[model samples]
Target chain A: MIVTPWKVSGDVDYNRLIERFGTRPLIRGLLDRLGRHAGHLHLQLRRGIFFSHRDLDWWLDMYEAGQPVGLYTGRGPSGPVHLGHLLPWFFTKYLQDAFGAELYFQMTDDEKFLIHPDLSLDDTVGYTYENALDLIACGLDPEKTHIISDVNNIGHLYKLALRVAKRVTYSTIKAVFGLTDSDNIGIIWFPAIQAVPCFIQSAREGRNVAVLIPAAIDQDPYWRMTRDIAEKLGYYKPAQMHAKFLPGLGRGGKMSASMPETAIFTIDPPEAAAKKVMSAFTGGRPTVREQQELGGDPSICTIYAYYYYLFEEDDAKLAKLERDCRSGAIICGECKARLAEIIKRFLADFQRKREKARDLLDQFLLK
Target chain B: MIVTPWKVSGDVDYNRLIERFGTRPLIRGLLDRLGRHAGHLHLQLRRGIFFSHRDLDWWLDMYEAGQPVGLYTGRGPSGPVHLGHLLPWFFTKYLQDAFGAELYFQMTDDEKFLIHPDLSLDDTVGYTYENALDLIACGLDPEKTHIISDVNNIGHLYKLALRVAKRVTYSTIKAVFGLTDSDNIGIIWFPAIQAVPCFIQSAREGRNVAVLIPAAIDQDPYWRMTRDIAEKLGYYKPAQMHAKFLPGLGRGGKMSASMPETAIFTIDPPEAAAKKVMSAFTGGRPTVREQQELGGDPSICTIYAYYYYLFEEDDAKLAKLERDCRSGAIICGECKARLAEIIKRFLADFQRKREKARDLLDQFLLK
Candidate 1:
């Protein structure tokens, strides 16, 4: 129902969330406008998973006007990279290729350490490197992307973070994040670090540059705070495109690394991924006989949702699968087996790229 | 009067402050212990200017046992470096020379920017370089001293600041610094940056080393928080040597750059120093005849306190001046003129050294 930076529970209503967040829907006209510049729209955009935006049109206007525009997206490296983590990054890579924009990929290892008491800096940094491989495996150009870990590129971030931090009050953070006085000071301070990337390019280049962030809706709060202070700090407010979360393989809710069985990590081997997909919850009836009579609900089916989200990129094939599920032409067992094959094949290719990404790490790394 | 990191007002009682801060008085035995290693006691110790300490004996124990110890002190570069700012730094240099310890002189440019919204980062950074010249002019050995500014050396500080920030809570900082929710998040996060220099040497040296901070009593609150989490973070609780504030020329309390006419800066020329001293608050009676007839109260005099703190180092001469002022043997104008000469002489040497310090800036700067 509601999404914040830290929590994602209940079944989200995307249209209601769009109104609540005061963002514009990615209507067909806007997609056509973006397509004019991008040559072709990304599948996520075409499918409407990236369904809402704040100032995206303004960023596009700047791009069309021949002004510089940069891309920013980040990961909180508290654990292994999951498929959910890769969703927005792949879209970001698509934007980078289309616009030929410089991408600042921040790895928020410091935020993870501050938020999780049990996690050490070393643990978060280890996760950062592992997650970086997944990002590289997404095929973002190394020369075009700058991978920055908050702990590693702190020199670049800290000064800008201080500028942002100086403009924000404790009350503002408390209100935005619902933080209590008992929260660690790092938690209170970290939003500033996250906001730094939005203006870092302008700071480095000595000129105003528009920033576009492609991320899941959970990350919108950081941008909200960043937008509030952007003009005051002599930088443009960063534009954002919010993507709907990929649902968990469980009964409901978004996929999370914390729920190991409900989420598939990028690092998970083919066998492990298949095992997870095989055990996923579905929208079929209690009995196979009842399912044959009433038919399955593909709208609520996790297996079909996977196809809608990522696996089945071909629109015609995805539509047929959805129609067949609803018509009871395909059973849960057959659907599950087919989804497992696609995921295993995807993982096989991803694992190979992830391994090769290890050597290219330095090229993408921000010193 | 009470002194925390945020508040410093009223006439302070050194003994009461020592008790309130839960620190030990630097008694004769500890001075004797230090003298055995230092060869001779500095004037600050001899005259009881550096009067209070926290765990100084523990630091001494570490030093006596042949383990490394570091000296940390800092300046909030809000404006020009005045005599009050130099007092602790000079003593810190004394400690460095005596113990052969590394000195970390932090220029808190980010703190200045956060605390004063009207001031820009450029302004604070400008003051940082200016103040670094003053610190260098104090004759701190560049070979052993590392000068770091929060804005400039943030890369080195950010990771460590994050660790300290995680351990500290908003309530803790609020209580320590009298912070309210209205305060900027930067101010709330700043104590962590200040705390970093205390542990940076140990972090770099790959072994736990004792740290001793020399600063005015106002700065003790930061060390209190640092001490609280040092053991939890696997570092020694940094020791502190608190100095009495150098009185402003106009009246009681510390000399601050904010009150320009009251504080003689190291950059102030001879004429300006003379003008400030001539208008300074003194112990003498209303008129020359009244002062001759009735004695003065040197105890409450800012001019006399200045001499006691830095200018008059010789015990006999300082005692004679105090006795003469109380015995109606000296007039305010003549006393002011004499004090002005000493300050002018000190500033003359300081200015020359400051000019030379520009050439040696790189040697002391921690980039």
Candidate 2:
């Protein structure tokens, strides 16, 4: 059994990744055009934690040819969208604007009823539509995107889904998704439902390759299963862009939107955002002089990590900050203060866009 | 737990049966009308054999008021309609012509597929259309009679059937139909499909208080399950008229159309019908004198039983035949000869009608 080498400790090898997933001609051209107009912000293609690939070149070819490749992103809508939930939409919105790709966002509302026993059937359907506004507010363009809720739109797609579902067996699903016996039969059946849209990407409804699924690393197993099935069903394998999990503010495991402090909502007030930042877990020693003598552990400091991920647009600014932190030229509190301003300014722009999107929710939700 | 008296023995105590179910207007009137039309050779209602009731009063009242309480009969359509299959149709056709009530005959194509794996999907569908022509040839008026096959006509009725099916459970179906784990799931799901049409009766495509199910007593379990489910689903329980099982020519058990010797098809030649009749199981001793010394048992004689079911039109003729057979006054040979003649002549008119019906098969088989 041969294993792919572009992985490190079961995570993506970031340095070897660029040559592994060479940028498509169209995306490279678009990046060049952006540099001409707005300057470069580093041409990075995020790789998911659980890396798997099939026919990436085909999608890249389609992208290079300026053919339409629809952006497919969806959430369970089990709860409110948090910082963790924003990753896919952030990339999707960017790609849609950058490459003019068609975007399709879905809410798996019917699946919630099957998964959550306490949820009333009617309430399960109502929540998906209600949550659609929040996703649109996250900068998804109505002109380029079509939003679908599983409850209302499923009827149109169910027959196709059921056909694919019937071909995949329970054992194969269990092996790929790590499903246990205690899981509801509905949950066991969920991967097939998600896989249907991947095969349905072409403009001809039941025809060829036009789908691109941008999901987190943990979700790669589902796409892998879909790819295997697509080969058997004579449907094109959907192209994938997998991203690593964003760590929570506590420097714990993955960030979860359902947990409050772990994820910052676009609506969080500036004071609250500042407080979250001040208390954010740091790896620096108590005194600045001790930190200067010992230098800093940037890997363990959550605040510095956030700055690298969210701010630090210039290479000189990032290098100076790293050197200053090591020499005690900058303390954790001063660094947090700088990070709070970046967060506040980012939220302000997002909130304005959210307000404008809310005004046009009817157009996105489409009744 | 106390079981009903009728549960112990299959036989119904007439007085007790009357106290329980006989007073229903349909039951009383059906018995009275069968008595009134006894003299007609071509069209007459059968007596004593059909002995069950549910909401029979409503239909009888409709009959008494000169309203359209039509004749209803069905064939399983697993095989060609035989001599035994003609019993219910014979009476139903008589009742239709005698009273001018609309007729609704059913071909249980779906049930065959459910119960027997050997019956292919194509054959199951084809049998219904083929059997419809047989029913039409048996003196049924095409305009007055509506023939339905379960699968083909499912869209016309499946929604109501599914609702009625849900109300019936594993426990209720198992008890009434004697289903076990070894039986196919299709068989388990089939009773409700059969039951729905009983409650809805007209398919809402015809007149009211108009449905009657003329079936064999061996199939009493299906309607019993139907009645139980109808009460649960809040639909009207249908009126039932059950014919006794016609015995097989060789075995003491019921005659099945699948066995060529037991069943005399309308397509059977006169010589073939005569040969089958001559070889039928008899209760007579070797010699006529030996039979006289020890009286023949009509219960064990298949030939005498056929006459009791079909040939003995009048009560006086049936009683005389029964007495003569028990006393050994009539030889089994002579009696079989008499029966063969009656059957041959009866099929002569049927054969003529069948040829005409075969030409009209296209009109009926169309949607």
Candidate 3:
């Protein structure tokens, strides 16, 4: 299984990912401690969608002891936001509310421009503005949330990035990202820019403040590199809660915007998104006759995974749907039709909120 | 000869440097062309101290055709400003005055902080302020000159730097700078920062502006790299006029601030500076009896070179001094004592101007 911040393919083994990324799995005991500190557990945590962590317990411990902790997550604005991109952002919003934490939403517009051969700075920055609306739709409190665009907010970020760059050797960058002499210098220099928000709070406040990064496990390498030099630079190593990727509606792989049929983009018309869900891959028998006799497997069904990952918030209702699918009480066509309507409704609401978000965009941006 | 932006050693052959740097020699024809255009030649150009050119003809061609051209040069503010550091700045002032071009004086404080292992950001930034005073003391027109501190003006420069970085590969930087994977990421990223001012005017004016860089020949590599990408980025290729180095007071190398006795720093007390000139290495026979018959070698004299490089502006006076030294008519002690007074008087006046520069510093600074 391969996973990187830029690419993800093949069938990922979540258990193996924990070891490969060198992150601690969010075990039951830690989850209990987290639930107690947060007062109410986020759905992603309760369902183990956020499966791994780095120093997360310490962040919660700080919160328990009455110290303020911060939340940071980023989106690379190369294209339209899709459901797969929202996994961590949704969790981030939940944390902001539960922990009463200040939030920093970083838009990696520069990264998107440098990495995409055809993209101009204007294209990426345009996408940054488009993507920020979706982030606002995630229900993050505007009062505490600040969206930071790398290109626009670079005046403040560049200074902090320099401190990070000073300590990082090219060898470390090469080893961490598998970059070589042929790579463009912009990408080679970008990890330091990516590491900025990890220390931004402390840099601004003139005092130490704990920070937590909620992102996909694919991004753990960046945090690992940041952790190595964080304390040396007089800032706390940022804590992280790593979430699992939401599988595409296709048979396999993480949902990507490149394959429009396999992923539902936020900007896609609600009807178009609903059509995508109806044709999604599912683990069912070839015929209805065989499905009723042998029963279907919910474990490998993309439709079931979607509900478990995003749609079905009520645990009892979700479990009942899973059981009914496995017991053949729910057939593939009927289940898909229901899931499609659920998605359509969610998208319709999201699009409305996203439109309303434009009014609040300027206020939510970090100057 | 060994020369990189950070290091210069051995006896430099100025003629050989043209071929090595892939630049054309500033022949008599080009000098004549320049004199006619500017109405006169700067002292450095008149004496062949400004020895090489790259696209300087094209820049002048544009000027003759009534298109505006610009000027750029930089300082790595790692320490106190010394006489050797003034070579290019003085010539830059001449270009700004003669050509009536806007000048960009880049202070590479970020580069200094990153490259020097023991330096803090504060140290390099602090030195940037000290060095800016000396730049103003060079008599650059505050009305047309801009002092760009890399750290302070990074809001404008980093965007341009990123564009440079996008086109450059790590292999190119490694080959041009001899940087390796062992170097800090900040240093690996710095060539782009250094290349920014070459394109700054074009970026700021929202149109093409031909730029000229005046610098010691050791910094030719940066300009070569910048010239390679200039046309690709939609700006006129920056032209360069490379200058020969001023020798140290005591030894066989460029005047270096690290060796306090070998360089005359602007901040050095006038009497202490006079003492340094008194003990300066010079062309003289061991004894007065041997000196009369054998004479002396003015060609190898550090003291005579100093006068030729900075102190003596009159070509006739400089030639007469050189002839007297070679004829043993000018004794080393008598010549040094006289040169000491000239430097002492020059410094006393310079110190006054340097202090007055504080009043003009903010005006010269690029926000």
Candidate 4:
């Protein structure tokens, strides 16, 4: 598997990824302890979608002691928000509600413009506005959240970025991000800017506050590097819960925004989204008649993954649907149509809230 | 000879440096043309102290054609301002006054704090204020000057810094700056910040304006890199006039701020500065009686260099002083005492203006 902040390719093995990134397994015991305080585990934690972590139990201990824990996650607004981008954000919203934590949601427009040479600052900044609406549509509490646009709020971040950058060398950048001398200096300098939101509350409040970051495993490298310099800058090392990337509708790989054919965007019309869902790849069962005598493998189905990862919140219903697929009671066409209808309903509600969010955008911004 | 933005070492060979850095010599023809418009050349220009240049004639042509040519120069603000640091800024003031230009005087506090590991941000920022006072004391018109502190005014600069950073690769950074992988990422990122003032007018005014930078030659590498990307960013490539370093009191080299004994700081007391001049290294004669028969070499004297570089601005009187020293008519003690009084008088006036600058600091700031 190839996973850097910029790219994730190949068939990912979460267990192997846990070892490579040196994170602790998100075990049953930790989940049980977390649920005790939260009153219930988030669906991602219960289902082990968020499979690895670092310093999470310590953060929970601080949370349980009535110390405030801040949640920091970010979006690099290069394009329209996709389902893959929403996966961790939805879970982060859950973390916020469950723990009553404040959220610092960073919109890294500068990173997108720098990493992608063709994208202008105006383009990324435009996307920043569009994506902020989608984030608000995810049902995050606006009063408790601060949306930080890197360029717009740069004066607040650049000094701390300078301090963070001083502790990190180019060797660390090369080793962590898989960057080379061919990469732009902005990309090399970006890790420090990326680390800023983790300490934003601490810097503003003039005291240490526990921070918990929930992001895909690919972003764990940034937090690992941030953790190394945290104490040196007189801030606590941020804790993180890492999630597995949501597979694309095409096949079993991370859903990417760059490939519009592989993922559904939140901004897409409900009907268009339904069309994408219908054309999505699934487990191959040649001919319906041949499948009546044979069993289908639900394990390889993207349609089945949609039900398990998001759509079917009911565990028994998801299990019954999987059983029906294996017994030939459910065919690919019907299964796809069911997932399509569910997606249409979701986008219909989401898009309305998204438009309404435009009115509230200024209220949420930290600028 | 070695020169990077961070370090200057050995005896810098100006002619060899002109060839090495690929700049045009400031010959009599350019000076004669420049003097025509300004009515008279600045002492530094007339004496060839501002020795080498890049596109200076083109900038002057633009100025002659009724286009605004902005002046961009900076200080890193690591410590108190020294004579070596003042050499170029004094000439830059001449440029602004001569051509009726705006000045973007950048205080690179972020660069100082980032490159110097032991310096806290507070320390660099404090020095920024201190250095800004000295800059204002140089007789720059407050109405036409905008003082930019890199950390405080980052919102105005970081966007352009990001744009500049995107075009530059780490390979270019390594080759131009001699930065290693072990160097902090901040040092690698700072060239872009240092380059911003060159295009500040263009970025703010929504049209390209010519900019002329007057700096000592160590800073040429940054301007060269800026020139490479200026057209890409839709700004005119900045013109430059380079100056040679002022020799230290102890020996031949750039008068370093880190070595306080070798340099005279603007904040230094007039008496203390005079005392430093009295003990300064000069071309030696074993006995005064023998020096009448054997002429002393004024060419190797740092005291003589002070008169040539700054103190004795009268060209005729300076020529006579050099002639008398060569003829052994002027002894070293009387020469040192006279030069000491010149410095004492200069500082006594400078410190008063420096104090007055404190009240006007806010008017000059870009923020």
Candidate 5:
């Protein structure tokens, strides 16, 4: 399946996408190399969720050589923040703590308004604040993180957008985004806005600073274009770490805000989240007795996938759960109940942090 | 024969352009209608230099009904402000003086930087200040004028540009500017920047105000697109008054800074202006004895055009000059000398005004 900035569809093949995108695999030993500098590898990195990269080794080399590196990642605030949205941000927090790098968290309110005809500026801006609370709850340091909404901080971005826009051609955007004549000019122009943050720190410091972007693979196209023009604009090409998508609860595709029932929003109450988890699709036999006699497939089960992706951090415990399911020792009902309890506990903690984040919002906002 | 926002070429037929663009001609009685409010018609209107319009009568009607009206005009700042560039600004000043309207003068430094690959942002912004001096020398009221360069005043313009950019589509800009796939994305996005000034006053005032633009026919495309989507955005449709181009010296087409010797810049010293005037092309017989027998054709003469357009505003004096030339009573050498004296006199006064304009620049800048 093809992954552009706006679309993610089909049964995505991660190994094939890495080859197609011409990015290097995050090899086994690279985590150890990163651990040497970071003190430890992030769960996402250790579990192979962040499986592909471009020029990351060079960026780490620069950091080890006592050069500056900044991190950039963003959210498109069309709706509430979902679990899918938090995956990269959590890793970003890890990177920040590990490398002591400054982070630029962009809320692309302008992008949402341009791509979605039904969304007004006010609507997207409201979502930006809601999404920002989730980012703050992810444990990023307020002093090192600069959370910027496109509309609120446009004064800092307009000049850089102009510089990037002047270099990118209409043909390039069309090929990258599948834009046609019917697309709004704002959409045609938005690539420049997305590209600006990659170099903004370098521009602000009046010198070249290596930019490292840790984001989902769906956003790779924007960085691909940014990387192509970065050196030409007198900055280092931004290095990217691509993360795998968290699948939707009910279906085969990634968790998306467009499908509310299939995604767990951070704002969802505990009861609602537990209900969704209980109803989520799983790979099991027709009957519990049949599943006890014939083993279920944990590899394709959403409950098992959730635990593997986020819930269970202990490798031995996760391996035991996978073995029990394959051996027909655990049933789907028990697995769902256990997953719901884990989710409820996680949400309880997250909700408290989110409330605390509200008071610190001003500190992280880019003025 | 064709005129778009980015290109103007061939021997343009004004009447045909008016027909093709679906604009109304500024007929004889409209000047008299304007005279009722303005006290007297400006020289450009009297000489039919302000030849065409779109919704101008409606704007005047709004003025008569006691509605607020604002004037908008702009420069590309790619080079020096030549005679062709000043034609519309002078007319804009006339409108501002007549109606006590606020003026928004945009210096499109960003546009020039995007369209001209060799021109840097510094180059275009440098030209903006030089062009602003020429605009101020044209006798505009500094208190009523707001001079904005795209880069300097982008903080005020970015939100409005986003609003404008969202409404326009890629096909519309491509059609209006003849942009190809190879054109930079900045050029594709620039129409929104150009369109922002038209509604800026209304946006700032928090109410609709009638906007009237005075510009050459080459800029008509921008207004055409602006007018189409204005009502959809809940703003008044902007009115436009189109002026005829000033012919270049020794040429059949408009005066342009690209052809340096053929254009007279506002910053040109009196001696240089006289030199250019002396070498100007004129309609005359080969010999003085033959010119006495065969009359010159003022219809195609650049020297005669200068007097009609700018120099000789007096009806009686201009009529006599035309009659004498047609009667073979005025020789080419004598005509050139008279034109040179007028140009020198005009430049001497303008240079002093331009020098004073530098001091008042802060008053006109939109911060």
Candidate 6:
């Protein structure tokens, strides 16, 4: 929800990016009604920092040309998603509806099964279909989207993978992906497998079209490698828009699904959402007198950061909140309450969509 | 046609083999006049050198049980055939008609195209059809035998080759095939490709039956590799009848297609055949008088060697030639004349059949 500022080495300067990319006037205007779109597709201008991309103009060009581009997003389905996992899918769905881009949501169930010895074919199949429901619930177009379970769809891409394997070398793959001594052969091939979909989606039947990928910054390594291979294979490289990692309510590092308490889920009740925010990590000084004189550091405070990303999208409102928090004018408790209310409304609508997606699962599976 | 005695190190010991694996008098007498039974197929007894088989009993078992076991043979299609190539097809045809085994004869046109870089596809295709005529000319049953070119029939075996490649390792492949640094990847895979036909002829709807490959001993390595793979793949290893290599009428080595004068071709005119023999390499002493005085070494005399292999089918007659050859009583020139006469008679029937085959070239294409 928030553009979590990244540190290359030491200090995080959020103002530099505001100056570089600039703020969207339309996003500033739509602060209250965030998810609504004027056209068939809805584009949510992301404040989250997923990755720092090089070429964003090509995606804008495709959008301007009325070309049929698509939103390609996937999950490993290793486990139920944390709050961190929702960032890409939500952003992807926003772009899908906003630009009317066709969506391809791949459930990497086979990859999970290959990597996780404990996972069974039946178990992974069950998990992948269930996970598809969550992604669909996030508002991706059921008719326009292709939610692929890798094993079931292996036949479609088997020949292409072999062709890709022929062109790539072991040395190149290792260097690009940062593969270490313990990496499995399947993992080495997994990147190319992912790259295949990026190339394949751009073509209807072997003609190159344009594409855009919205994903977390960590996944940029795979796409970078994909960029190198695209021209070699006579396909276009997809432009990327990366959102920054959302920190857990516990603060510091990115939110992890493995530790459930630190991250909130859409399925979580209103009461639980309110309770989680109240106990969130804070940056206020201990003494009441000292805290009143010296305001909290909103940069270090997880609750204030959440408001900037999710609750308050207007630059003026965010600037006022940052000033009040730093000057000890607004307390952390009031900010927490505001975030809890915003999160509650978001979850209620998301949960309703989740229920509708479950009913439509059969329609997606039909031929 | 005479039994072409294929030599490894020296002359073939025909009399010794006649005592070793020859049919019993009663069996031989019954086979010589046995009428073709609709339910029971028979393997026609060819010449003496095309003897010493591994698993003919299983095929006989299948036939006795009223199951159809087809026959298969192939020509290399490198050039116009010498006398050595004739005996195999001659025997294959006799088996097809006499025993009613459905025969499939392959012309390795694709292999020739792969191996001979100077050859155009048109040249190889033209030569294969031409050689198919030669094979049919050798008296093979046109209705019973299905003759095919490698290029057309390659798809039948490609699936089997991929399956074989997955099971074999690079190290095992290198060791078995004598592959060196400069060999092409195509050459490395050539053995697996070759082994596919053995499996194809034996498989009916992917079930492995039995196959009998009648080739010279030098080709044993191919079968040995096939045998190892056959067991691994759960298919029956092709049973083989390893014949000895026929000596060239030139120097000490085997007859090569590159040397036009060393071997008697089916297309060779009578005068040319006679001249080739008269001037063929000899193991005789200084002069005709000395040859008569000192006796000839039949082991080193190409003229008498051809007689023992091809023209002299009468066991007692071959024995007399051998004895006369060793005693210096038989002149090399006199021996070549008798052999040439026999070869000329064989080519008369061959040319007539070949002429008929030429008329039905389209029939061989199966297009």
The digit string of per-residue lDDT tens for model 6 on B76-105 reads 676788877766665666556655766667
Q: Tell me the DockQ of each model, to 2 decimals.
A: 0.87, 0.06, 0.80, 0.93, 0.76, 0.05
Taking the tens digit of each residue's C-alpha lDDT, what string does model 4 give over A162-218?
Answer: 889999999999998889999999989999999999999999999899999999999
Scoring only the second chain, what is candidate 3's TM-score?
0.98
TM-score of chain A of each: 0.98, 0.81, 0.98, 0.98, 0.98, 0.82
Whole-model lDDT for model 2 versus the true structure?
A: 0.63
lDDT value, residue B135 of candidate 1: 93
Q: Please write out the lDDT profile of model 5 over residues A214-328, one tens digit for every residue.
A: 9999888898889889988899999999999999997688998889998998989988999999999998888999899988998788888899889999989999998899889
Predicted structure 2, TM vs. truth: 0.54
**Candidate 4, B184-279: lDDT as tens digits:** 999899999998998989988888899999888889999999999999998999999899889899878778888888799998999999999999
Of candidate 4 chain A, the 10-residue stretch with the lowest lDDT total is A289-298
Q: For model 1, report DockQ.
A: 0.87
The TM-score of predicted model 5 comes to 0.97
- Score every model by TM-score: 0.97, 0.54, 0.98, 0.98, 0.97, 0.51
lDDT (Cα, 0-100) at B311 in candidate 4? 86
Which is the better candidate, 3 or 4, if ranked by lDDT? 4
Worst 10 residues of 1 chain B by lDDT: B1-10
TM (B chain), model 6: 0.81
Fnat for the candidates in order: 0.94, 0.00, 0.76, 0.98, 0.80, 0.00
lDDT of 1 by residue, A1-367 (tens): 6699988888899999888888889888778878877788778998999999999889989998999999999999999888898899989988998899999999999999999989999999999999999999999998888999999889888878988999899999998888999999999999999999999889988999999999998888899999999999899999999999998999989999889999998888899999999999998888888888888998888898899889888899988987777777888999999999999999999999999999999999985
Candidate 6, residue A134: how far the Cα is off, in Å: 1.5
Interface RMSDs of the predictions, in order, are: 0.8, 8.8, 1.0, 0.6, 1.1, 9.4
Alpha-carbon runs more than 4 Å astray in model 2: A1-367, B1-30, B33-46, B62-72, B97-103, B201-210, B231-234, B292-295, B323-329, B362-367
